[model samples]
Target: MRIAVAGGTGVVGRHVVAAVERAGHEAVVLSRGRGVDVATGSGLDAALEGVDAVVDTLNVTSLREKVATEFFTTTSRHLVAAGVRAGVGHHVLLSIVGIDRASGYGYYRAKLAQEEVVRAGDLPWSVVRATQFHEFPGQVLGQVPGPVGIMPRMRCRPVAAAEVGTYLAEVAAGPARGQAPEIAGPREEQMADMARRLLRARGRRRWVLPVDFPGAGAAFRGGALLPDGEGPRGSVTFDEWLSASQA
Candidate 1:
């Protein structure tokens, strides 16, 4: 099978690429580094040539709803259009679990928009919603940009990005299931506690504060972010990921 991974060089995308290749399939990377720009449809058709499946793991760091929505929708439309032209069979999207429930958040709303675009497209598509990555705490801290980190108090089941990537690869290679079972970690955890543990693992001396934010934050605190139904759970725990990462 020839698998093309959009945003193939990104955090989770990289793992998808690796897993695809490891599965004895040809992995074509659709990323800027490979001269395939998904956002504008540049070099995408050529890169997608002879591709059987396309796995989109592209990401945008913006917190603004408009910005994130535009990016996801535009890229998705382009990918679908090109996939139709290239005779690509399956279109796979990596999405966040419970984003629909937390639509109050700008980024989550953007993701919801992206999922809608993918679902409405002509090409056969599959949406794989996964929980927060183990590295999410670091990402949260990076957004704060301060000596003290302020993270939301939320219930989470953070999974390893690599596990999600591998799972996405498996899904992309098979027949399209409109919505695959949501994936999460083995154990439930608190977001703020995870952040503090992450900092402690890094041997950093900083105060990590947990706040009850408004809107989406409240939803998160209320368990809207955790996976609701039974689904695939990753093996790695936050503590294990943290310890190995720091080691």
Candidate 2:
């Protein structure tokens, strides 16, 4: 199979690329870094040429609602249009679980918009919604902090990004199922506690204070963003991810 991975160089996209190649499929990485700008439809046709399926894991590093939505919706539309033109059979997209339930958050709102566009696109598609990755706690700990490093109390079921990537690759190679079952980690965990543990693993003495954030924060705290009981759970624990980060 000749597969194209949009955003193939990104955080999770890289793992998808590797997994596709490992499965003896030809993987073409499509990204701005690879000369294909997904947001504007630049250089996309050439990338989709001779491609059988497209696995879209594209992402933008932004918290603003408009910017995130613009990036995703535009990119998704462009990818679907190009896929239809090139006769791409299956369009595989990686999305966040509970996006419909938590669209108040800017990022989740953008993701939901993107999913909607893909679902209504001309190509046959499969969308896989995965829970937050174990890496998210660490990413948050590094980004959101005061002098004392505070985090908000919330519930999360974090899967390994690599496992999500693997699931996406498997789905990309299989039949289009419209929307696949949501995927998540094996267990649920508290957000602040996970943040503190991440800090401790890094040998940092900063205190992780938990607070309530309005809007998006409240949604997170309300468990509006966690996956439900229908999906396959990944085996890796948060502690395992932490330990590996230390290595």
Candidate 3:
């Protein structure tokens, strides 16, 4: 089987590619670095030729709803249309678990729009909604830099990016189930605490300010990011992952 990973060089995308190749499938990387621009579908059709499945792990770094929505919707539309023309069998999309409940967040709303675009498309699809990855806190901290790191006060069940990658590969190789089970971490952790721990693990001392923001922050603080469904869960805890990652 041939599997094309849309964000094949990304954090999760790299793991997906490794997992797919380890499973004895050809991994076609669809990225600008590989000459395939999935964001606009410019080089997608030729790249998707003879591809059996496509896993969209594409990511955009924007907190604005319009920007995120446009990126996701455009990439999703192009992928679906190209997959149909290329005769791809399965289309797997990586999404967050609580986008439906946490639409208060701009990025979540954009993700919801992207999911809608996927479902409305003519391709056989599956949506794997996972919780935040263990790297989420670090990502958040990097977005806003200061002498003290700003950490949002939120509860989350964070999984390993590698585990999500493996799950995506398995799903892509199978029949599309449309809204596949959500993947989450084994336990929930506070994002603010996680941020502090991350900084500490790096042997750095920086004050982390935990703020309970309104709207999206409220939803996150209210535990909207916690997975309610009994889905596939990773075995690695945050501390365990942190320990290994830091080592």
Candidate 4:
């Protein structure tokens, strides 16, 4: 099987590519860095040649609603159309678990729009909704902090991106399920505490103040983003992920 990873150079997408190859499938990396831009449909049709499935982990780091929506909508449309033309058998999309409930957030709104496009596309598709990654603590610390590293009050169940990647590969190899089961971490942790732990692991001493935000912040604090009922849980804990990073 030949699998095309649309954002193969990304944080989780890179691991998805590796997982696909490790599972004995040919992995093709599709990214703007490789002269293929999914958002613009550039080099997409050519890259779709011999592609059995497409795993879309493409992402844009923007808080702006229009920018986010445009990126996702355009990218998904191009990927699906090109996949149909190439006779690709399956289309797998990676999305956040709580996008449906938290559409007020700009990024989640884009993700939801992307989901709609995928569901309405001509190709058979699967949307794999996943919770936050343990690496998110690090990612957030860099983005949401001011003088000292602090995280706003929110609930989070952060899985390992590597685990998310593996799950994506598995879904890509199998027949499309339309909407796959949601994936999450083993346990839930407060965002501020997670940030503190990450800071401690990095040998930094700082106060992580937690602020209560309204709207989207309220949704996160209310646990809207945490996986409900049962979902697949990865084995690596936040501590485990940090230790491995050190090693």
Q: Which regions of candidate 1 deviate over 4 angstroms?
A: none
Q: How large an RMSD does model 4 have?
A: 1.4
Candidate 3, poorest ten consecutive residues by summed lDDT:
212-221
Candidate 2 structure quality by residue, lDDT tens digits, 1-247: 9999998987789999999999999999998888998888999999999999999998877878899999999999999999999999999999988878766677787898899999999999999999888877666766766657766677889899889888898999998989899989988899888887887887788777887654567777889768765778899999998898799
Colliding residue pairs in candidate 2 = none
Model 1 lDDT per residue over 165-192, tens place: 9999999999999999999998899998
Candidate-wise lDDT, in order = 0.92, 0.87, 0.92, 0.87
What is candidate 4's lDDT per residue for 1-247, written digit by digit as tens?
Answer: 9999988989999999999999999999998788897878989989999999999999888868899999999999999999999999999999998877776677788899999999999999999999988877677678765667656687878899999999999999999999788998877888888888778788877778787543487787888898875667888877788788867
Candidate 1 clashes between residue pairs 3 or more apart in a chain or in different chains: none
Cα lDDT over the full model 1: 0.92
Task: List, in order, the clash count of every candidate structure.
Answer: 0, 0, 0, 0
Model 3 lDDT per residue over 1-247, tens place: 9999999999999999999999999999998988988877889999999999999999999888899999999999999999999999889999998878888788888999999999999888999999999999999889888768888888999999999999999999999999999999888899989998999999888899998665687788888888887789999999999999998
